[model samples]
Target: MDRLPRLACSDPRLTRLIAIYETLAPATLGALEALFAPQARFVDPFNDVSGPAAIRRVFEHMFETVDAPRFEVLDAAIGAGGGAFLLWNFHFQSRDKQRTPRCIQGTSHLRFDEQGRVLLHQDHWDPARQLYEGVPLLGGLLRRLREHLAAR
Candidate 1:
């Protein structure tokens, strides 16, 4: 953690984004638009959406699909050209019969506009291991395939 670059408190945009994520919920989902520009783009393992409305829908789906999804920022950093990076964990319980809670480790790369609103947000994560492998039927098959591959 010591080696990770800390986002300065002065960076209001990034700070606010972090704050909202830490306390994110269905009601607060609307506020996420304030953190991004009107035409901002967001990309993740399963989504490629542009604009605040589209982005909000993704989060909405997350909440609707998962039991209790939340994000925890472990570290953050600011880069040149108003860019930022956030290392985080998404924890949730599957809505299916597999009600066990799980955690997905991921990182987000963000580019902000002059107003400190995000222009582009891209997330990096492994859906196969973090999500699909947790499913009941698919999980077993995926786990077996993973084991076979690892043996080689």
Candidate 2:
């Protein structure tokens, strides 16, 4: 919430994050270390990575099959200070070519430390759409059914 970027690429910390996302989105293990303190904690529904080493492990395991990672920053707003959230569309290819380059839209909430390095990096997205639904066979259909019930 603090240390908001004025532009998606302006802040040094944000820049590092974007650079990592561009090159390592699916498999960015060690690259993340540069963004956080040695003991920083990162939490997502799938993982609660504590410390740099564990976070790196999560990234390494995540990148196992995801490839050709690319990001499209659709919209952003620069604040008076040094931070911002860019609505992003993350597209990538999986080893399962049948469902290659699936587009998953998400938001990365990043903050900077006093030194302007990323202190907190949080992400928000629909796990169903970005992940579960992208699986093969009944994935999409199953997601639809879940959505249908949730709407009730």
Candidate 3:
């Protein structure tokens, strides 16, 4: 099993981003029914969903495959210089019975709505290195490289 300590959902900005991810990961449609702006849009490598319902659906799909997932904000910087950014690491196990937990890094660029809901969320990460390569022998190699990169 793998664990990534979650962020404290106290600061309003971090709270919103954390809420979006949590509701998405577990497909907790009800939890997000009123959380987003009616015209909000969310995009990622595998999903480009608009409006709350569509976003909820994308999350539902994610829950089907990802198991026991957690997203941790390793660090964050915010100021008038630009929008807030969270340096995050995502960790999860696959639903595949034999798989171990997988970890990946991403940078989340966030903007708040007029009401402080997360309006735009752009995630930057490489699916090829973070996810696709996490399969068996290929995964071993990726893991080795990832560890090497981390050590540096």
Off by over 4 Å in 1: 1-10, 147-152
Candidate 2 residue pairs in clash (backbone atoms < 3 Å)? 4-82, 4-83, 5-82, 5-83, 5-84, 6-78, 6-83
- Model 3 is weakest, by summed lDDT over 10 consecutive residues, at 1-10
Q: TM-score for all predictions?
A: 0.86, 0.69, 0.70
Clash tally for model 1 = 0
All candidates' lDDT scores? 0.87, 0.65, 0.70
Clashing pairs in 1: none
Could you give candidate 2's per-residue lDDT for residues 1-152 as a string of tens digits?
12233444555555666666667653445666777776566666677666777777767666665776666665454455655565777777877747566777777665565776555556677887668876676687978788888955
**Candidate 1 vs candidate 2, lDDT winner:** 1
Off by over 4 Å in 2: 1-8, 25-29, 75-84, 97-99, 136-141, 144-152
Please report how far candidate 2 places residue 105 from its true position, in Å. 0.7
RMSD of 2: 5.5
- Per-residue C-alpha lDDT of model 1 across residues 1-152, encoded as one tens digit per residue: 22335445567777899999989999999888778899999999889999999999999999999988998887887887668899998889977665888888999999988888899999999888888887789999999989989955
Residue 3 lDDT, candidate 2, scale 0-100:
29
Task: Supply candidate 2's per-residue lDDT for 138.
Answer: 68
Candidate 3 lDDT by residue in tens digits, 40-128: 77788877777878877766766677887776777666648446788777788877878678888888776667776656667888986
Order the candidate numbers by TM-score, best to worst.
1, 3, 2
Angstrom error at residue 60, model 2: 1.3
